[model samples]
Target: MILQDFIAINEKGIYCLYGDFYLDPKEPVATAVISHAHADHAVSGNRDVYCTEATSAFMQLRYGKNAALTFHILGWQQQINIGGVEVSFLPAGHMLGSAMVLMVYQGVRYLYTGDFKLQPDATCEPIQFCQADVLITESTFADPNTAHPDAGLEIKKLADIDINIMLGAYGLGKSQRLIQLINQHVPDKTILVPHKIWPLNAIYEKFGYQLGNYQIYSRKLMKEQRQFVYIVPPFTFDSYIRATGVKRLFASGWKNLQVNDKDTLYISDHADWNDILKAIEQVSPKEAWTLHGDGNALKQHFDGKLPVKIMN
Candidate 1:
């Protein structure tokens, strides 16, 4: 029972051979064990899907009847057997309902993290770690120099500006997070969201995470309110690139998405370099495997200390 024999990257996604399921498959498959409902990770047309209750709700909202033929909802830490392999989910802290897949075969544990973060977020569950023989993780911000600043301080930056703000964020996780952050830190500024994002917010609220206050976007309402933040999805934000008056800012961890020095909100849902290292330390895996971003730095850092493999 080698690590590769248990689970390895294939054309579809991170395939669990022992379980006969795909973790976050790119294309639809027979059985998909989704970590979250994000478009890139959870796609439509899968015959069967296994994920958290919140993830299932999100997928239904996003994909409707096309979400999946069957959704096998599993609570956190709940164990199930598939293809003679024991499987479970742990909080990933990346977003609401995000999970780190755990598979055990022949007494060896393999943990597959599907995008994760270490920051404290009121809108989502915090990450939980467990010891494993092989640790597979996403290295989105795995550079030695990449360290995400405190999200609280970053969100407070919105309070300094007195003008209306056109805040751009992803609809599912990021949009809801920004709404909560603005309500808690920048209460003076009214929060506005587009129609597409409103349903997702409702879903979050249904899950008992209260997002303070927000209204669906309105051109007239935006004009009436002087101190307000209008949060729009990426597509809407791009369409309004030339629109006038409001200060344009995109909330993301990527430096390139910042566009300019002033129009940047360094709020990211992905784990940074230090967070990744901390995760590895916490997991204490015999061998580390990296995906999603460059793994050379991790490989170099662990040279002679612990074996590291870069999964393509």
Candidate 2:
């Protein structure tokens, strides 16, 4: 088994390390293993793609029939072998098709955290931790000061507000979490979703989450609003929320986002500072490397604890 520290953003491939081989210059790799259906990781132009069924369908719609070279629908706890690399997909707690891969190549296990969250998002499965020989984890929300507060309390406060509550989040992970929260807490009323976000709601439904009767944003419905809570993407707030007579609120990892009379919920799609540590500790990895948000900060916390690579 051999390992190297070289992650490069190649023009030939979406993102890859230097030594690793890529298939096509235009559509590199006959088989590409994807973690989720987020536009960033699951780019168009790949031939044969190996991702979850949820992501494969999403790719088909966005990239056409030939978007994926092939399909390898990997579910949770399922393991497959690819050229001596024993790969297993685990729940990442990010979205419907999100997964964290644990690969064992020549007896050395490498865990890759492809955007995971530990706190139970209202809409998805809780994050799963596994032991590995080496761990490569995401640090999207690695800073301790940026840790989120109790979601249950914040949501209750928002729902109790005087005006209609509209939470601004992305269409993927954040939207589902909000829908789950609203469904669990306020299942009595009709939940409304912007048309663009309807696609994601369908994916969540495939995962067996019951989000109750969701409809498109309509003027008629807004006029009849009685303490209704609407979940939407951030762009929808600017384009539609104001017209609907709903007060705007934001839920994202970014700090100090601009908003008026709006409360910001610090929910994130990646593991927090403590969760990151616990993930590595649980694995008891022989070596560790960090990528994504504030990796060095996460590395500093694990000093003298494990062999870690922060960046360079």
Candidate 3:
């Protein structure tokens, strides 16, 4: 069997080998399979791309009509035969339309997990046990020693405060999650967002996520409400939310980074150490290959347990 990573970063854009596999280095790949709608994972380019219908709609807002048909809309668990390779989409639980690619050929199966969380989330389907001879998972928060508080409890602790609470998270799945958690718990106050993330909010809205009464911050809005919840990108702290008197709370898998003075909470879209171990055990491959992260760490954890190989 032969394996290779076709994705590489360059000056202009990414050279994609699989997702939007295209020939011309100057143009986007001719056939791309998007994992999700995140800008980092899915971006518009000059060619045919394939993704879930929800993802195509999200791309349409970004690239206009050009993104709609350029994509082959697939549903979750749908199987397709591309060339001689067999591929299927599985729920990754990162966000709406997020997927893990399962490829089978020559009697071996490979599952490429694109930012998945095992816990049931608001935005997408629950993560399930997938059978793959080779599993490729992310290590965004791979440390075994790191632990996070219960999501519900931690969210309540922040919202219980009587001050204006601005939660720092990514505009995609994280922000919507915060909104849902806060609104259901602390219904009196409204949810909020940064100005730029409003469009992403609209995209979420298209999928029937009803986020009510969220607006970008303003002195007028602040003066009226003594207590509210605001969701903004973590980078917004540097410029937008730094000056405000509001209390800051950061949510990410990497609370260990100590990047902010605000209260830190570890909530992530990737599997924790235990999740990784369990996934590996469940797959129980005769030979295991790890990639898209530090392979040695995963190896060390599974040491003496399985046949492991380092994969790029």
Quick one: best lDDT, which candidate?
1
Kindly list the per-residue Cα lDDT of model 3 for residues 1-312, writing each as its tens digit.
Answer: 534453344543434444434211233555666777777777667466657777787778777866534667788888886655677788777887788877776676777677777766776666655777767666655668755556666676665668887677887778877776777666777777777778877877877877556667675776677686777676775456455678777777775533465566667777777777776776665556654466677677778976666644
Q: Least lDDT summed over 10 consecutive residues: which range in candidate 1? A: 1-10
Considering summed lDDT, which 10 consecutive residues are worst modelled in model 3?
18-27
For residues 168-269, write the lDDT of model 2, one tens digit per residue. Answer: 888876777777776676666556787877877786787787666667877577667566667777666767644645667777667764355456666566
Candidate 2: where is the Cα deviation over 4 Å?
A: 5-28, 187-190, 240-245, 258-262
- Candidate 1, 1-312: lDDT as tens digits: 446666678888888887899999999999999999899999999999999999999999988999999999999999999788888999999989999999889899989999999999999999999999999999989999988888889989988887889999899999899999989998999998878888898889999999999987788987886788999888998999897878899999999888599657999999999999999999999999898899999999999998999987
Ranking by TM-score: 1, 2, 3
Residue 306 CA error for candidate 2 (Å)?
1.6
Report the error of model 3 at residue 81, Å: 1.5
Better of 1 and 2 by TM-score: 1
- Best-fitting candidate, scored by TM-score: 1
lDDT of each: 0.91, 0.68, 0.67
Clashing pairs in 1: none
Residue 134 in candidate 3 has what lDDT? Answer: 69
